[model samples]
Target: MKTVQVNIVTPDGPVYEADVEMVSVRAESGELGILAGHVPMVAPLKIGAVRLKHSGSTELVAVSGGFVEVRPEKVTILAQAAETSAKVDVDRAKSAKQRAEEHLNHPNESDVRRAELALKRALNRLNVAGK
Candidate 1:
């Protein structure tokens, strides 16, 4: 069986590091699926959940935004922020979502985009946590 070394890093520290069969993430172009022996490339990632497949199990991780560096033997993710399902607090994410929505209602032109991104990050965490 082939495997690719995967590492997910955030400003705080490494969120994940492992050898896996495959991984998938939301790239600027869309969802990009990477398997062992994939072509080398670099892409920007959107605010969403990244899925990784190991032997027979899958894990979901949420990232606010990031960049993915792909190589035949490894894949590296540099994320602005990241969270695992077990580490996420559903209530907190819900509250964040609500706050973001409220901010959007006020519609500050300068902060509207930031508010939307906050909502996206919260929703991504909720999805990863299966809330």
Candidate 2:
């Protein structure tokens, strides 16, 4: 089976670096999949989960937002922030989700959009964490 070198990085540092058989990411256009020998292209990422499949395992990472660059034998993801399931704090995510939901329900004129984004981020983390 063919594999591709996939690297996921953020401003602080590299997050995930691995050779995988396939990767699926949330792009602006929607969910997209890439495999070894994929056409070279760059796509803006959305706030969601990045799923990668290797020899016999699958890993998930929650990303705030960023861009992905795909090449014939390599793929790179530059994200604003990222969190792996093992590193996520379920309680914190749940709290954030609750706060965001409350804020959204109250409909604060100034913080509504922020709250919505926060909710999305919280949900993304929870989803990756499987909680």
Best by lDDT: 2
Instruction: Estimate, for each residue in 1-131, the C-alpha lDDT of model 1 and write its tens digit.
Output: 78999999999999999999999999999999999899999999999999999879999999988899999999999999999888899999999999999999999899899999999999999999999
Clash pairs for candidate 2: none
TM-score of each: 0.95, 0.96
Model 1, global lDDT: 0.94
Give the per-residue lDDT digits (tens) of candidate 2, residues 1-131.
Answer: 89999999999999999999999999999899999999999999999999999879999999999999999999999999899999899999999999999999999799999999999999999999999
State the lDDT at 74 in candidate 1: 98
Q: By summed lDDT, which 10 consecutive residues of candidate 1 come out lowest?
A: 81-90
Clash pairs (backbone) in predicted model 1: none
lDDT of each: 0.94, 0.95
